[model samples]
Target chain A: METTHAARAGRGMTALRRTSGIIAAVTLTTSLAACAGGAIGGGTEGGDDVFKVGLISPVTGPVVQEATAMQRGFELAIEKINAEGGVLGQPVEVVTVDDQADAAKSTQLAQRLISQDQVDYIFGTIPGDTTAAVAQVAESAKVPFSSAILGNAGVCGQYFFPFGEPNASLLNGLLPQMIADHGTKVALVGNDYAFPRGYFADARTVLEELGATVVLEEYSPMGTADWQPVISKIKAAAPDWVLTAVVGADATALVTQADQAGILDSMGFTGVSLIADFYPGLTDRMHGLTLVGRYSDQLDNEANKEFVDAFREAYDFSDPIPSVAANAYEGMLMIADAVEQAGSTEGADIAKALGEGEVENGVFGGGSFNEDRFFMTETARFEIREGGAYVPVETFPADIEGITPRCA
Target chain B: MDAVVTLALSVFTLFGFYALLAVGMGLIFGQLGVVNVAHGELVMVGAFVMFALADVPFLPRLLLAVLIGLVLGVVIERLVLSNLYERGFLATLLAMWGVSIVLREGANAIFGSTPASVRAPIQENIEILGVSYPLYRLIIAVVALAIVAAVLLVTYRTKLGLVVRATVDNRDMASVLGIPPRLVVTGTFAVGAMLAVLAGALQSPLLGVTPMVGAAFLAPAFFAVLLGRAGSLPGAIFGAFVVALLSTVLRTYLNETLAQVVLFALLIVLVAVRPNGIDWRKVQWKPRTQPAQVAA
Candidate 1:
């Protein structure tokens, strides 16, 4: 009789525990539902009065440096504008999406920013593929979009504004001087892709015009593990200068291997889109490397100093600002000035104002838009100093000839 | 002549790395009959482990990576794979794939996808046959070959090897013989995982450590598995060497895109001609009198 009574008590306890679990689940579900509803309703409040801007960047991939720099530039610009009473008497807001340099994901995120977040303007992106994807979405949605790093002509569209110096303009100004100083023979090593190929095509024209021969043109697939063969080939070719169209980890690997092979100690390493952000990690290997860029940490200009100071103060970002970030910073400030001059938040109006020359005091000074919607800005050349920082060697004036598109 | 010597050294160095990856992948497929989609993640785990222990010397860091990989393999086998063992091939494949996604996203979430680099302990250049080569690459090649030899000895010359071979041949028969198949499965997977981690740790300096670095090795490893005898260890190593040789030679002479095209075409021809890969001599094709049935 005592055993039976104990069994009955155990069953009752089990039933109580089951009931409590169900109750807890229901309470949690109810709370989540309420929170989601509140979030949706909150986004709808003020509607058109709130100017929402969406930023698409590769925040977690091999291009994190470029993404982080772009984020800082956007944040700094947004903060400054908000402090001075934002556009149209409403505060500006930003939504950042990490594309991770994937085109399909970029499309999904761009659509979400447009349909879900109801973002009015789209500001983006570091990679060529992601930039093209975002630009397509913005063009369809009639949202003002600006690209910060992509300089390819294929990505240019009606509603898209490219703020970086295009490959054509960059190569046109930088290569002649390189050929004159380095040698008449060049070896081109790049990843097998459209961006690198496009840069090579543009550079080839300039090289041929300057009477320099491309000794060898080799392309490796992305994520290639071994580069010794390519290094051996480069050494065999013995070009006066090695022009690398590689980026991210491949760029690092090529530079590292070349240095290890003592090729950097012998030849001039110069090219378009071979970023130097990863150079600091390879301080001992960067003695003979030079790259053409728009922003350098060792620039002697007051404008650059002020921008750098404000950037550090605002984002607490201590590293040398990538050239792409400076492009984004200037792009954001230019967008703000255009919106203020247009006196409206409409995409077309702001684009028109931007075209009509509303933003003059750019980060680098002298910023204007061409018929192709590409930003015509100054390009600078920098060589790696004794330590790791890049020091400015030369600066090119803004071009009126503008960017030549690779496509219709 | 110097260039030829350099090219030969490169092919040899890459062969060791590729062999490590292929052998581990083959062992799992042969014994477990489950294609471990999470194999690449195991490789990533190894790289991250080395990055975490960057201050330590290479051998100790590599040993730690092996231990961690073994623990992880055991845990995965017990908690997830053990239940799915009887659930058929599709179920196991999907489960392993889900695990792969979880691991990749987990690394991204925890480590923030920032590129972490490993400073090679041996940073000098060594001259080989009048050609200068990175000293670290040479070390990796030597260590990898040693590892391959050791694993071969362990698998072919031990009591444990006999049990593992029995389990691979027929799990039910092995179980009926009182040799627990579960223990064999767990042990084989642990060893495979250890090899993968070691390979990743050794190659981290050359590749530049990133969360997605393992994906680059995944396709080639799978190709090696397909080219070799599926259930044979020696065949897998031979297949790795062949694949590595083709890749190096073609990539040297032609562009990467064309090289991949030719490589895939070669794989198709091989599959059509010899379905058992290079291990047809070991396992004879026998006509089945009974229809295959699902395990209860």
Candidate 2:
């Protein structure tokens, strides 16, 4: 009788536990889906009088610093534009989505921004993958989308307007000057992705064209912590300049590991689009490090100064303004100009205007969309100082025009 | 010669970090028969703890992290894992998966998605055999090895070790013999968690401390555990060293993308060949008949 009772209790316990597990799993899945779904839904639905511009930023992932900077810049532009009687005689309303740098999440959020929020114009983000995802949504929706920092992969087409340095332009605009200053023998290190590989291909062509030799090239998977093996190879190669496109947290690890291994002492390090967000953390290690970007905080111009001053007044002025912020801020201005030129907030109309209009005097040293519908801006070089600050060293003319995309 | 030494040291350094992760994960799996997908999150929590205690010195912060891991482990085991212990592997895995998501998202929500970091206590480079390397990296490697040794000693020499071994070997028989299987499993899990947290705290200076940073370490650690003896601590440690050396060498010689492809292919071959991954169960460890007979 006792054995029977124990057996019955054991079976009952198993059933109970299984049921609880199922319930827990269901609850968690449902909750997560709800949380992710609900976030992109609650936008204050604006009437035709308001111009809603959806800004997709990776506010919660590996590149949060860059994303936050982009967010701040967008907000600053909104504040300034609103102060100046708004865009297209309507109050420019901004809807910010946290993409988290995850492509899947970015796609979901992009759809939400377009369908649920009814955003008129959309601004793409810093991380290449997220920007690409957002671009897909904008293309399908026929919305005017502009990316401040898309990778060289030409992920944007048709309705999208990309103004930043694509890999070809970035390499052409920056490498020649770097090869001239530092020696021609250059080593490339970057994340093993299409963007980095594409940039490296561009670098080799540009560097060799400039009468420089490509010494060593190394690529690591994203988020790799151990860089010793690569660093050893780099030391052996002893290249005149080491350029890295390794980004986000992986960049942090590589720099830290390289600094530790004393690889930084042997070579002059230069990177493409690296120094802005991570400047503070890398202050002590930035003795010989140089980077190229379209905008710098040290730009000595009235427009830059005004933008900087306004940024300081609005946010943590003590914090360094990353170049990405300038790019994003300029992107917003470009959108406003496009809207004004088009005389309508309609996606097709704005995209047309974007191609035709010129951002006469924005934060990114004033430029206009070219024949290829890419932003044409002068690139600048900066040397990082010991105290986590950068000094503008040189500026290149906006000669490197955007590439004609062949992506289907 | 210098290249060889640097490569060896690099592999060794990586192995130290992987050992902690693999052993901790192996311990949980050996005792409970469930892969704790939340193992990496425990490491992440440790990194966060170090970030929180930035004002505190590195050594004290690490000790505090271990304590936090212990408390956290106990709570997780008692509230969630204990009920799922007999509910089969799939149930436990799903539960742990849920736990991992909650911890990762909870961190994101609380920490506000910004990557946080702690300064390395030893900022200068140390010269070893005419090669300059980060002193902190050397220290982390040594500390991790010491932790592995400590865990090995506790597992092999103590009365609790015998109970754990018996429980792992035959849970029903061990339970019938008056060994509290739940307590043994919970205690082992806690110890494993504490070690993982310590590894994370020690390596915090070297890597970026983001909410999702743990995902980076998860694959290598899992590979180490997979290639090692499933229930053997020593096997796990040895396997981690092998994996680290292989990964370092491959990544050095080939491009990172190609290296990963090769590594996974190699792992698949190894899994097929070994089937049970170098069985350590065949080796007999004579347990003391009495608790008093166990070594100090």
Candidate 3:
């Protein structure tokens, strides 16, 4: 009788616990659904007078810092443009979407921006994978898609406009320079992902063409903690130069590992995404690290200074605004310029104006987009030093171009 | 030669961390028959505690980190795990999984989703076969080995060890025998959680502390537990070393994703071949002794 009563009591408690669990699960599911729904359907409706641009970024993921900066830059540019009588006398309003740095989420956000919000233009995404996903949506919908941070060649096609250095071009241009200046042998290290592998392959082809020997290519998973194995391989290879293409949290870890292992002093290290944004965390370890990009905070140009100053005054954060943010800001301004030139917010018309051979001076030392909708501009390389941020070491002329033959 | 030495050093260092994680899971599942899926979260908490202690100037940060891990382990066992005692496998599994999500998300909210890391205790590199390696990793390996040895001694030689063993065999019988099985179970859980904390605190300097970082450690730890047989300490440690070595070698030679898939497939195969685990026979089930016939 006692055992039966105990069993009944236990069953009763179990039932109560299960009931609580179901309620909690439902609440969580509903909250998440509502947040996603709000992102897709919560904008002021039928307001055709306002030119709405959708800005998508990883606002709450591993790359939130970069995403936040890009968002700020876009907002700042829109503010400035609106102050100057707006685009085509209609105030430009941006509808921001948080992709959370996930590729699938980026795709969904792109669709929402196009079909749901009816945005005039879409901009911003840092990682290559996220950009690639968004590019497809833009192309299918025949909407003008311009990216600020992701500059992989794979992202460039009919409907996409990349406002920064394409992966292949950056590698082709930088690798040969590295080989000519340093030596013929180099080691490559990067996060194991699509962007790094794609860019490294480009660098390998360029290095081989320049009679350089590829010593070793080591990859660590994204967010990997240990670098001993890879660093050990780098040491063994004894390459004259090392090239890296990791981003976000992994970027910091790799730099920290390299600094700890004394790889920076032993070999010349160059990377594509290692910039002022990633350098601050490295402290004294930032010295002698080489990287290539479109702009640095130290670029002595009026437009660059103005953008930096405005960002500093607005954000009030001590950290230097990342170049990714600056590029996004500039990209937004360029899109608004193209829209005004076309005198319409139609995607097709804006795309044509963007490629109409007009010399538009906006930011990052202005250059006109070529027939391919990518700028044939000077590439900037900087050497990071202690306390002093990424100081510009050299700049190649805009006319000097290198095209990567597509790999089969 | 340098490459070989470096690879070997990496394998050993990785083995140390993996072993610590595996042992923690082994203790919980072996002693309590409850799979604490939130084992990795306890590690994350330990890492954060180390991050907090990083600025203190006086005592060795490493020691302070271990102490923090111990406290966290005790707290988690007392507050969360004690209630789940005697709960069936499915219930405990679901509860722990939910706890993991809450802890990970809560960590993101508190830590702001940014990766934070503490500096390695020793920054100097040790040269082996003309290759330089971080001395901190070597220290981690030594410390991990020491803890393992101490745990083995305590479990094998102490009176508490006998009570724990009996409790694991039959909780109801042990409690009826005046063992206070609940206290024993909670104590073991706390110790297991502490082991996880130690592993994370030691590893935090090498790997930055991110909310989702626990997911990475969890997979390998589970693989180790499954491969070693559910409850064997020695089996778990051996499994951890083997898996770590295999993963490191495969990653070096094959594509990263392929390596992960291959390792998980291997674990599945091991489990299939030995459903009762590697040391199934060692798990003793107490015989049902007839209650003394009530006097007529």
Q: Order of all candidates by TM-score, from best down to worst? A: 3, 2, 1
- State the C-alpha lDDT per candidate: 0.73, 0.74, 0.72
Per-residue lDDT of candidate 3, residues A1-408 (tens digit): 122322432343333224435546864675456448536322765365466888886776667767877788888898889989888887787778777777877888899889988888888877778888988999899888877764554656667887766665466557767777789989888877777887787777677778888898877677666566567667768899888887665666777788778877777777853666665445566676566766777788788888878888887755656766777778777778888888888888888888764434455676667765665556677777667467778886653234442322
The superposed Cα distance between candidate 1 and the true structure at residue B40, in angstroms, equals 2.1
- Residue pairs with colliding backbones in model 2 are A163-A375
- Taken in order, the candidates have interface RMSDs of 15.7, 8.0, 7.7
- Residue B173 in model 2: lDDT: 79
Q: Which run of 10 residues does model 2 chain A get worst, by summed lDDT?
A: A1-10
Stretches off by above 4 angstroms in model 3 are A1-42, A60-65, A82-85, A313-316, A357-363, A404-408, B1-4, B57-59, B84-87, B129-131, B169-183, B255-257, B279-296
Q: Stretches of candidate 2 above 4 Å error? A: A1-50, A60-63, A93-118, A125-141, A150-158, A167-177, A300-318, A401-408, B109-117, B123-135, B166-183, B280-296
TM-score (chain A only) of candidate 2:
0.85
Better of 1 and 3 by TM-score: 3
Cα TM-score per model: 0.84, 0.85, 0.85
| Candidates 1 and 2, the one with greater lDDT | 2
Weakest 10 consecutive residues, lDDT, candidate 3 chain B?
A: B275-284
Question: Can you list the residue pairs that collide in candidate 1?
Answer: none
